[model samples]
Target: MVQTVQSADGTTIAYEQAGSGAPLVIVGGALNNRQSAAALVPPLAGDFTVITYDRRGRGDSTDTPPYAVDREIEDLRALADAAGGPVHLYGHSSGAILCLEAAAAGVSVRKIAVYEPPYFTHHVRDEPWEVFANKVKTLADTGHGDQAVEAFMRHAGVRFDERVKQEPWWPAVVALAPTLHYDLTLEADGVVPEERFGSITAPVLALYGDASPDWAVASAAAVATSVKDGHQGVIPGHGHDVPPEALVPFLIGFFHE
Candidate 1:
């Protein structure tokens, strides 16, 4: 069912709630909306009241002026309250970064299960991200929205099938590409502040794909140390866009444990 909740800053956050049992909020990474998570939902929904939503400025959610990371955390807190409080957070890509950030910022969380947050320690450089962000911003500012999406995806190293260029969802990516700034800003040079990560006290299950970049394992392992009870999981044949089957066992074991 479609529902709305007022974020701490009064922005209206929209979400779709399905299935039953414990509440689990699925936070998608860049360019992801509820539709992008449809395949994983059925499996998780069997054991959870799975909630998938559009982050602000994407899909059905509203955006507030003067964006800040704190505001997004407030958005998640609002959804958790709406979902009966202290909900589980299942985050993908940069959404996992937001999940960790939210828990560190003191949002009520029961558990966090994240897949391949883009936190890099060794295999990435700091300078290119700034350059990339500028190019994307310029294209978006000059109204080349579709080009902006392509540029962002390319810079992020996503190899989409050529068929996607002709799909109906291509337009959605074009529309949401501007939010890349929000996602990139959350990375903060691909490393969060020590105190900030040190504050994550929740039990975290961090996952990474074997087929992802060489830094994926290193990044995941580093993030595991940030949380009090964090652990790492591996998917043998997946990348940043992990196959749902590769993640099923981890989700079931962690959430049901």
Candidate 2:
């Protein structure tokens, strides 16, 4: 079933709920909404009441900006409240960052599973991200949404030409060019402090792919080291993008326990 929750900031956050056990909230990466994690949801719904949401400005969610990371956190809080409080949470990429911040802010998160959050340290610098953001911004300014989506694919390490054509969500990514800048801004400046991580009371499962960027691995390691009850897993063949089969089992084990 689909519903709307009003965030503290008054934005209407749209969410879909399926299944019937412990509630689990799934947060998707940039340019993704409830549909991005479709492959994992059915299996997950069998074990838990999976709550999938369109983060602000995407899918069916409403967007009212002066975008701030805290506002995004509030959206998650509202969803958790609707789920009857303190639900298990999972986030991929930028969504992981949001999960971390929400837990830190004392949200009633039961457990968290983070998949390859791009928390760059000195070990990895995001040169391509800045360039890509600027190029996309230029394209959007010039009203070239198509070209902007192409640039986003390159920045995300996804090949634009053949694969984008084959993927169903490629056009949706292009349509959301205006909000992509908000994601970049958050990535560049809104990292959670390492010291604050220790205060998160929720059990955390940090997953990284062995083939992921050095920085993402480093970030996962750092998060595991800092959180008191955190565990780390390295998926052998995957990178930042996790296969649904791999992710569902990990999440079910952690959350349903």
Candidate 3:
């Protein structure tokens, strides 16, 4: 069944519950809602009461302007609390950053699986990110959601002619470009605070694709090193877009252990 919860800041966060065992929350990558992880949930439902939610300003969730990463973390915490206590958490891409931050903030995450958070070091420049953020905000403000989405794809290293043309969610992501800038801004300002990963006491499992960018691999390793009981793994034959089926078994085994 689907359920809705009003965050402390009045945004309506929507979530779906399935399966029948220990509660587990799945947070999707940037520009994706709960449905993005659909493939993994059904199989997992057999052994877990999986919870999937629309991050703020997407899907059925309401958008509150002046977005803060803390607000997003709170939404996750609210869902976790509702699920009982100390539930397992999993997040992909930016969602990984959120899950890590939530765990560090004393959210009672029993175990966490993070998939390729894009935390770059000083070697990486923020100029491109800033430029992209501005362009996206302008496009979204000017009613050019399509263009904004295109801008986002370019920033995320998604090829122009391939996935964008064939994937069904491409257009939908473009339609929600207005929220894309907020997502970018949250990450740029270090809202997730990469330096604070050491504070997370929960056992963390960090996953990265063998074909992912060098910076992504480095970031995942850095996070794994910071956590007290963190482990890192590489998904073979996958890039940043790791397949759900490929990851489900890993997650089930880790969380169940």
Candidate 4:
């Protein structure tokens, strides 16, 4: 069933739930909404009451102007409250950063599993962020949001096949271009916020793909080291976009324990 929760700031966060077990909330990264969790839901549903949501501004969720990291954190807290209390969290890419931040803030969460959060060790953010953001802002503001999406994808090393460009879902991506800038702003040079990660006392499972970039490995490693009871693992034969199956077993094991 679809459910809605009012975040502390009054933004309405929409979510869906399925299967039956301990509550597990899945948060997707940049340019993603609830639909992005489709691939993971089936396999995970057997073991968890999976709750997938449209993080504000992405899908059915409403957004408040002047975004702030703490606001997103509050949205998560509201979701957890709706789930009947503390729940496990699973976040991919930039969404993983949000999950870690929530846990660090001592929010009511049981455990967390984050996959390849775009945390850079040295200097992964190649260009000065404002330049990149300005380019995207210009394209999105100029009524060429699709091109803006394309630009952001290219910047992220995404090589889209012609067939992918032809897909119906492509337009949805274009429509969400502005949120890409919001995400990049949240990323902020991809550096790990050491103070936050280190402050987290809840158990964390930091997942990195074998084929992921060096910076991803460093970031996950740093997170695992910081959390009091955190663990790290590598998903073999995967890149930055590790498939859901590679994550299922580890997640089931961690949350069940």
Candidate 5:
């Protein structure tokens, strides 16, 4: 059954947990809800009490106006508290950036792992950050959620094909378009904050798929070196959307270490 926790600002955050062991919270990336991590849960369930939650402004969770990255950190802190102690936190894409920020902000997490955070040590995209940011923000704030989603996907190298549009989850993804702004906010210029991350004493594992672009690999490496206790891993033949089979082994090994 899904449960609820009140964030520091009183927005209700919805979540569910399974299995029986140390708490392991899985944070979804942009356009994702709790269901995004559904496939990883059962395999990890045997060793951990896997927890997945809808971030504020998406799915079963409710949002407060005036989104702030710190508020998102508080949401994770609330989940960590609800788990009764520190947790093993895992995040993907923009969610990975949030995880690092939370750890740096002193959330009680035993360790953190991230897959393919979009940060780049060397800027890759030709579009100026301000131009891209404003374009997406205007589109989302003007009630053109579908357009905002399209813009984000296109910029991220995701193809906007008819097959993708026909998927049952496409509407759900578009409905989450506004949260794309929040994800961009978390990324903040798409560079790793070395000084900010230095504050995180917890172990961090930054993983990238072998098949991903060189920029992603470089970013992941930068992230690993930024934290006090950080490591990097490569999952063979995977990309941003890493399969559970390729990902679970890394989580099991890292969290256990």
Candidate 6:
């Protein structure tokens, strides 16, 4: 069953938890909700309490007016408060960017681990954010949500053809089209803010798959080197979709240490 927590802005954030011991929150990337992190729970559940919540505006969570990344940090703060003190965070893709932001903003983070934060510093985007944002906004605002989702997916290198559209989960993914701007905003210009990262006091672990794109690998390295106390690791023989077997060990080792 889902539980609720009230963020600073009074938005009701929905979440579920498993296991026991210290709190560990898993923040998923764009188009993902609380359910999206379910695959990771089983393995890590044995070592820590796993909390997976829907980012506001998706799943059972409610959204407030004029979304800001700070509000999302407040949502994380609420989760941390509910966890009963400082909490560990593990973020993937754009979610990792949010984690870095939260930690830098002085959220009570004990430690943080991120996987491929999607910072394209090494390989810049072809078009400016305004152009892409307008296209997605227009598509989503005009009731062409499917097209909006497709545009974001294509930009993210996801295969969104007819076969994918026929899947049952496609509609849920499309429904999250409005939040694409949230992720895009987090990634503004695709440059990694090294100065902001320098402010984070928590130990940071940046991981990228060996088989992932060169830019992703470089981004992880840049993140690790930028922070005061950061480490980078490679998940060998893996790509963006890292399997639980390969990922859990690294997480356990890092979070436990």
In the range 43-94, model 1's lDDT, one tens digit per residue, is 8988999998888888778899777899999999999888887889999888
**Candidate 2, clashing residue pairs?**
86-108
* Evaluation by TM-score, superior candidate among 1 and 6: 6
Q: What range of 10 consecutive residues in model 5 has the weakest lDDT sum?
A: 120-129
TM-score for each candidate, following the candidate numbering: 0.94, 0.89, 0.91, 0.93, 0.97, 0.97
Model 5: number of clashes? 0
The clash count for each model shown is: 0, 1, 0, 0, 0, 0
For residues 149-186, could you state the per-residue lDDT of candidate 5 as single tens digits?
Answer: 88898888887775777788888888898889898888
- C-alpha lDDT values of all predictions: 0.84, 0.81, 0.82, 0.85, 0.92, 0.91
Q: What is the model-wide C-alpha lDDT for candidate 3? A: 0.82
Q: How accurate is candidate 1 locally (lDDT)?
A: 0.84
Candidate order (lDDT): 5, 6, 4, 1, 3, 2
Error (Å) of candidate 4 at residue 95 is: 0.6
Pitting candidate 1 against candidate 5, the one with the higher lDDT is 5
* Candidate 4 structure quality by residue, lDDT tens digits, 36-114: 8988899989988999999888889999988788888999999898888689999998899889988887679989999
Q: Which stretches in model 4 have alpha-carbon errors above 4 Å?
A: 160-164
> Candidate 1: minimum summed lDDT over ten consecutive residues — where?
120-129
Clashing pairs in 4: none
Which candidate, 3 or 6, has the higher lDDT? Answer: 6
Residue 257, model 6, lDDT: 92
TM-score of 6: 0.97
Model 3 RMSD vs true structure: 2.2
| Candidate that beats the other on lDDT, 4 or 6, i.e. the better one | 6
